[model samples]
Target: MACILRGLIRLSGLDKCINLVELNLAGNQISKIEGLEATLQLRRLILTSNKISAIEGISHLSRLEGLWLQDNRLASLESLALPQLAQLPALRSLYLQNLDRLAPNAVCRTPGYKAAVLAALPNLTNLDGERSPAALNYAELAAEYDAFRANPVPPKQWVVPDVAPWLAGVSQEVPMGGGPGEVALQQRHAKLLPLRFGAAPCVSGQVVKVIDECEMLVRVLGEEIAKFGRQAEARKSSAVAS
Candidate 1:
């Protein structure tokens, strides 16, 4: 699911989607990276151009393939960054920078950042959109990871004590704005705007407003009708399965 530039303030409403394979939430005001524990099968996780300052509660995404976290506020490496990602054995692509876009976490500026990351996650084929050297023996690097995993050490707290929500998969913060409801309300008012003039088109407003209002209403209602229709249609198609 791609939800880019939606003005999302918080990362909410992905708790129960255990089968979610990919999620892209770029260009938003999200401050924290929480929720999404149930999506163990998730592959591509894109969260660039966000305000994410910390990375926690995102452990054990073993099936993740691509992770994009560039252009964020992540700082520090040892404290919470690497440990949260240590379990993603299937992750092959990790992006933290975009050439001319110049998007990178604060930690990327630190010396040996690339080397240290490659050393830790041996399976990565691409880092910051650059391919790892073919000459590098990934098999040799695998042993080091195996050793580290076999005798894991507890990670220290990042100032505050590390605490996950009572429910791991629940959304920590809901995005600001009433979303569709607010849109619908605005549209309803706009739809009846011309009515305010009592049967006269002399209200003198943008035609875009009327179109927006009607479209928003149609979209909102159409989705509801489609949702129920799908459920009803499914039963007709397969009675035994239903």
Candidate 2:
């Protein structure tokens, strides 16, 4: 049975079909290859026109013979998870062409592309719809590829301004008994202050306002209770005298 273009984000709930074979999940949003570890009988698997970025999590499909992955977002051959594919002894045919995100001069576009793939998967008899020929001299190419993988250039770091010192300056301005100008200044700019700098600039004033409001409400309630008690006692005394 084939399931194509189902708009599935994940390959869940398919593990129950242990005997199922030939699953086709083409033209979907499946980004990862997973949830098919139990389908040991799966021979042909097609995942075309999807949002797949990496090629991991398919080592369990040991019986898979044919695999198709075309018109997806594969950026480079390194994302192919070649080491895992080597474990699939039955994998003879592989389709990896017309990848939307792969560059024109990408490693997959070079002459060594086929050689690298063949070197990685020695059992592959067909690749990208072409019949594999006699083994090519892929030693030098594989060595270079391995070296590049071993020592890739580190990614650049992003530097952002420190917000601690700026927050300290703002806190120092709010006195224990600040004047109305200071309070007004804080209130006016409190909302506009950039909170992304790892400090809650408006919290101090908000906390103070909340405490003051609660105290005022308690005082008002207490006064009302006292007034009610006095009126009740006066009415009882008046009734007893009459």
Candidate 3:
């Protein structure tokens, strides 16, 4: 352990010796995995917490089989190439955690990093304490669904028939059938009609006028209805002719 820490003290360790295996240099101030390639027989390398910004040195450890590098500042694993580990034919497990620290605020900004990490460690069937990737936090996702179910929608009021009948009359007349300008106006009135007809079934109103004045609304509303009636007659006549 001391030798490993010494090696990481200034990004240099175990260069003089050989025949070493199972080294752990976790929780140090080291910002990268430098040196230690001297340990040709090394199998397990655990560098859980440090300042590892990159994972390029992994390619040098041909004998390395198991690795754990969680809680680091690694922004990306795209530059890393660990083909030598796979050459060992002994590599089985690789742990990668704390990736949330890579760019906790902007994960979507870096998509290639996730792909590179998976590609570099192909034989790694067991990852991040899981015997398989299926051992992830499914319960947390279920909890989110439960929270969404508990949320309530806003309340709405019911519409009266007296108000809707008047509105529908307007929709069928000048605004809807009289000309193109009235088409938009008719659709707007149709939408409001549902509320007037108690479709909301929550609240009720005594008097429902299209707007402030009932007399002007009634007159224009009738004209719209008459126009739509004429279009309907024309359509019926065409159908009969056909």
Candidate 4:
């Protein structure tokens, strides 16, 4: 038999009919379902856009080549167990569309969603229109829709914990004599050390001043040492007076 059971429901004995190839139960209102394994030879099962939200009973149809599931309230497709369908040796195509809950604008716009779906379903070559869901211009529309849906942005938290520590330490005394070059050096170190330590450390002004005074002292001492060397005899007489 090429076909059988055009609209049979709750008939447990229909399982004995193994020669059936095509079964069409489009509008039987057969919401609750079980036991269709008798039709093992079935190739095409047309249950398109029906109230069958859970495709649990259809898993045993190993010979099924095509399934039409569209225009349904299939919110959680992740729950639908179609592992066997993916492994179907003869199955070439599977159609699932018109899911009401999933926002058409959101799914098409978000790059993250598209990336996740493509990674999950490699065999699913086409969705909505393009070959890859990544090509959709959903990001823009989704941003607008999300802004409309979400609550207004809260005020800026400038006095948060991250800045609070710095605020408390800002009043501490620090060295006062560092020159521009020394201060610049300390600031540069401040930026670089933060990366190495993975956090910024509090720097004192005293250390900065000390750095500048040291630089000035080095310059003055070097000039005195050079001039003293040129007048060793005069330096000896001066030392006697000391």
Candidate 5:
């Protein structure tokens, strides 16, 4: 562990260390991972608590097994590729959490971060020096479920019903035939049903399971209706304010 207050600003002057197997450069001011291409026999690399943002270089380390890169400035793992951890076959152990040295990287704070990492690097036997089989398994399952259904929705104009009649209760029946925008409103909601259910897609199997899915569907439908009512109320308020 190097001094946290003062550390190397750059990684250099290791051209001669060709046979270096393990390199520990924790708690440094180094902003980049560079100047280690000649270390062909490199195995273990520790680089915790540095200013490094994007993960680059070190694609030549074919024999690498352990990698420590906690407390860095890495943003998102989605943007990294070409020579990513997946390309490294021998890598088994990885450390990417900060304790007392400095703050953890931004990727660590992302939702399903561990799942993303494990999904990208399936061979990783250890993560952050430990393993929780239950959590990892759930993450993997969640990642798989969202992979295909996760579609980017485009901004489209939607015609929502004036909900006042919808909320007028059973005493007053809503018109059997809506006046003008009813067809467009129905069509719009038809298209949006899939988008709303994408998060909690239906599961098929036993009778009880299908019943549970139906229950969830009813609950989501109720919530969506309530949300539309609220949106209509908000629009009315905004119009009055103007």
Candidate 6:
């Protein structure tokens, strides 16, 4: 059965659809080719108008007859070699049209591109909607493949500096007790202390009213503390009696 879907980042939950023969996911935000490892019966696979940067993880589709990957962000054919196109025994037709990034490269621009792809995958009879030419020599294709593989592209490297010592020095100044900022913040909070009854201390009125409100807040806090102390004493006396 054929399944036409779109706007999927990855193929995570489609493992149960093992019987699916054809799958089309045109115009999606998918970056990597993956999550279809269990679809062994898949023949026709289309992934057009997406953000796929490399061609990986499709070698597992042994039964894939036709593959379409048009208008993607693939930079080169290096990713195809890693998966080994020769591993796909049933691949016949392959489409890689409108690859803006790869089109600029000399390897992709020349007429030898078809020959290169044919050399890469001997089983491929059609590429980019064109049938393989009958007069194409196998010896020449092998030599081309050999020349292509002779100069290997180097993998990119990343170097990260150790900033742990610098971070440690800064952290030492702001230990568990906190730094000067924390002390200043505490003093500010004390000035605008909250009342026990879930209300901010009234400090916006006349000076006399503000002073009265502060005294009232102090009295309420003292009363609450005394009441808590009495309750604790009562609980202790009851425990002794029991």
What overall lDDT goes with each candidate model? 0.70, 0.72, 0.58, 0.55, 0.68, 0.68
lDDT of 3 by residue, 1-242 (tens): 22355345445747865777777787677776767778777788877676666665666667777877776665544323355545556667765563333312122136654445446656666655445434344335557777888985667878765544444444433322235554455455554555655546322111222332465778889999999999999999999999
RMSD of each: 30.7, 18.8, 20.0, 19.3, 23.4, 19.9
* Backbone clash pairs in model 4 (N, Cα, C under 3 Å; residues 3+ apart or in different chains), count: 8
Best by lDDT: 2
Better of 1 and 6 by lDDT: 1
Clashing pairs in 4: 109-138, 109-139, 174-205, 174-206, 175-205, 175-206, 177-209, 178-209
Any runs in candidate 6 off by more than 4 Å, and if so which? 98-107, 133-242
As a whole number from 0 to 100, the lDDT of residue 153 in candidate 6 is 71
Query: How far in Å is the alpha carbon of 227 misplaced in model 2?
Result: 99
The all-Cα superposition gives candidate 4 an RMSD in Å to the true structure of 19.3
lDDT of 1 at 41: 78
* Candidate that beats the other on TM-score, 1 or 2, i.e. the better one: 1
Question: By TM-score, is 4 or 5 better?
Answer: 5
Worst 10 residues of 5 by lDDT: 167-176
Candidate 4 local lDDT, 1-242, one digit each (tens): 55434364443566677888876655454553466778888787666545555656666777877655544434454533445455555554444543232323222333355455445545654543333444554445667778977977687878545444433323233334556755665665554333333255545344455545777899999999988887997888899999
lDDT of 4: 0.55
Mark the regions of model 1 whose C-alpha exceeds 4 Å error after superposition.
1-5, 99-101, 133-242
Off by over 4 Å in 5: 1-6, 79-83, 98-103, 132-242
Local accuracy of candidate 5 as per-residue lDDT tens digits, 21-57: 8888888889988998888788888888888887778
> What clash count goes with each model?
0, 0, 13, 8, 0, 0
Which stretches in model 4 have alpha-carbon errors above 4 Å?
1-13, 98-121, 124-242
| CA lDDT for candidate 3 | 0.58
Error of 3 at 56 (Å): 2.3
lDDT ranking, high to low: 2, 1, 5, 6, 3, 4
Task: Give the range of the ten consecutive residues with the poorest summed lDDT in model 4.
Answer: 99-108
lDDT of 1 by residue, 140-169 (tens): 466788899999988987787889754444
Give the Å error, residue 6, model 3.
7.4
